[model samples]
Target: MAEGGKGSRSGSDSDDQSAVETNLTATVNKVDGLEVQLVLQVRGLKPKGGLRSFLSKFSNHDNPTDLCANAEFTKWDVTSSSLSIEICVHTEKERKKKKGKHDVNTVNTETFTYKISNFPSEIRPEKTTLEIKQPPGETSYSFIVLTLQRVDKSVSWENFRTPRNS
Candidate 1:
């Protein structure tokens, strides 16, 4: 009886350890025009809700925004122990049609796959800032800085400009 009790307690302790939440960190960069890539090394991950449970709820709902509020890193690849996501940055002119209003420069984003097997050699380095925000009413947020140096300087206007006719 004593041995069985000890075994059960050890199993319960292991289960408790596995349920602990872990914070994830990642490196992000923009490569090849408007593509943003993220490289994450994660040991374990847990969303606010279970991934499958959230997806099931999302599929039954008509509004797409609900899914965005529920899930994290929806587009990810888990191979062995690494995760990568390649997203696209979309910029649009948001014009408010009111009694009198000017055009607004608002940016929106979409996700796409960006593979970086052989990075270009003539690209310069640049830095990008990222801010992670929770839902509008929540007070949880994070700021991250990323270094992305991949610009081709050879294609600038100085290389192909002719002297203006004076």
Candidate 2:
């Protein structure tokens, strides 16, 4: 009975995840003329420094990590069009002035780009998850999640209707 209970619980958890994914797709793929937005949410990060690096999995809803990227375009414009996201994060050097010793962690700015070429023009909505990798040395963080979704909008008059006492 305990085994069966665990199986059911896992099944329900998968169901919940599937439902959330479905809702995200529905939200992005509606009304052919509205707009398609690329939202970058950082799930985790680790500043590279050998074994001393700390992995940060951000879960703060109140203060989210700024990915510094927001790209939006029309449904028709974005359809079948190539998209490239290039971001550069620079970390300055920190000086430790204790006991006349200076420890500097100077990380340079890296402008890395990830591109999606020729998005499918089919009527079916598509979703793709990409991993933005960080170079081996002198970079801010490594291993980030990037979700790509295209929305189609077919505007309706009901959206613009005002309340009336007919």
Candidate 3:
């Protein structure tokens, strides 16, 4: 249940789903303990195949045609059993002339959450992808892509934290 928070996922460990070992990467802009940038490959945006791919089309109307643009990881929390990934997407930004300075700002954030667990990652990389799996009772191979998943070491932080002022 990775894309746009649709579908239920099986906690059962099985190999029926297609496993694509993809190495994930992100753009780390601000590291005051929050806001990690995710560089989404446009190709990955398209579902691997099947019903999920068909459903993906309808779910992305409000979002940009290209899902990778201006993407960031707003939340990265890990526990003993699972890792929580919350990514937010923004539309193209506009620069406004404020006094003598020009400031770039964009709004209208769309978020998608994914849970990373159950299926074990054979190896750990700096950055990694969340597997998109069909929930229990759905066809076994509808939509499944095993992507590399792990936060890059460069974006170091002791624990998940929000803006200090917040």
Please, what are the lDDT tens digits per residue for candidate 1 over residues 1-166?
0000011111121112211222334444334453334333222111233575456543543322232332234333323222233332232334565577654444333322322323322333223322222334433222222233434533332212111110
**Ranking of candidates on TM-score, top first:** 2, 3, 1
By TM-score, who's the top model here? 2
lDDT of 1 at 32: 43
lDDT score, candidate 3, position 156? 49
Whole-model alpha-carbon lDDT for candidate 3? 0.35
- Candidate 2, residues 1-166, lDDT tens digits: the string is 0000011111121112211110010112222343333333211123333332223233222211232222111111113345444443343344555687656444333333334454433222234333334446624334444334444444332232111110
What are the runs in model 3 whose C-alpha is more than 4 Å off?
A: 1-3, 6-68, 77-81, 92-106, 120-146, 149-166
Where does candidate 2 stray beyond 4 Å?
1-33, 42-80, 103-105, 122-166
Score candidate 2 by lDDT.
Answer: 0.29
Best by lDDT: 3
- Angstrom error at residue 146, model 3: 5.8
* C-alpha lDDT score of every prediction, in listed order: 0.29, 0.29, 0.35
> How would you encode candidate 3's per-residue C-alpha lDDT over 26-143 as one tens digit per residue?
2222333222322222112322356644666466332222223344555565443344555544433345567987554434334444554522212243333343333455432222
**Which regions of candidate 1 fall more than 4 Å away from where they truly are?**
1-55, 58-66, 69-75, 87-105, 108-136, 139-166
State the number of backbone clashes in model 1: 4
> On TM-score, who's better, 1 or 3?
3
Check candidate 1 and list the clashing pairs: 124-151, 125-149, 126-148, 126-149
- The positional error of residue 79 in candidate 1, measured at the CA in angstroms, is 1.2
